[model samples]
Target: MLLINCPFCGAREEHEFHYGGQAHITRPADPEQVDDKAWADYLYYRKNTLGLQAERWQHSFGCGQWFNALRCSQTHQFKAVYKMGDDAPEGLQ
Candidate 1:
């Protein structure tokens, strides 16, 4: 029974949330000017680390708000949780 903390609604079961892939991926400001390879990289590439990873999750069963979490991929331990637009808590990056 894994639990995830929602920035808006406190801790909730894992089933209450939706995994939204990697976090902090910013879209190109000038998409039309980006090269084909860069575009492909943006669409397909991700830094799949085995240790601590930053990811996005939606608290679907609670507040339905999106937030970011710094988690350990191998252990599933969540280190920090924060709102989507806020800067990550210190010592996370």
Candidate 2:
């Protein structure tokens, strides 16, 4: 099983954390002025990258805190972990 290291609580089983999809998604500044296509893209489109990817995760069973991680999608190996609101190491956040 995959093991995820929580930024706040250290390493733990994967089940303890919840995958929150791709991270660093910037919402439009003016939502009301956004067209249907833009809004749809914002809601449905995702990077879905195969290599190093930034994702949001919550330590549901531990501190219940949220954070971001850079993990390899192909190998499930994490490269970095940082807490929410913290500046991303690679400027991805």
Candidate 3:
């Protein structure tokens, strides 16, 4: 079984967590000013990478906290796990 490290709860089985999709996506500063296409893009589009990607995850069955992880999309290896709102480790970007 796959193991995922929760920043607050240590390592746990992957089934105890939930994938929250790509991380670091920014919302429009002024939603009313954004065009329809831009709004749609923000809601529907995400970067799909084959290498290291920053993603959001929730430790649903553990700490019940959200965190970010730098993981390899192709290999599913997690390089680092960090708390929400904290900066990712240097050079992991």
Best by TM-score: 1
Q: Quote each prediction's TM-score.
A: 0.94, 0.88, 0.93
Q: For candidate 1, lDDT tens digit of each residue in 1-93?
A: 998888888878999999999998889999999999999989999989999989999988788888999999999999999888877888877
lDDT tens digits by residue: candidate 2, 2-32: 7888877788999898999988787999999
Per-residue lDDT of candidate 3, residues 17-76 (tens digit) = 999999888899999999999999999999999999999999998889999999999999
TM-score of 2: 0.88
Higher-scoring candidate on lDDT, 2 or 3? 3
Model 3: lowest-lDDT 10 consecutive positions: 84-93
| Alpha-carbon shift of residue 38 in model 3 (angstroms) | 1.6
Please list the C-alpha lDDT of all candidates, in the order they appear: 0.90, 0.86, 0.93
Q: Give lDDT: candidate 2, residue 18.
A: 91
Off by over 4 Å in 1: none
Candidate 3 global lDDT: 0.93
- Candidate 3: regions farther than 4 A off: none
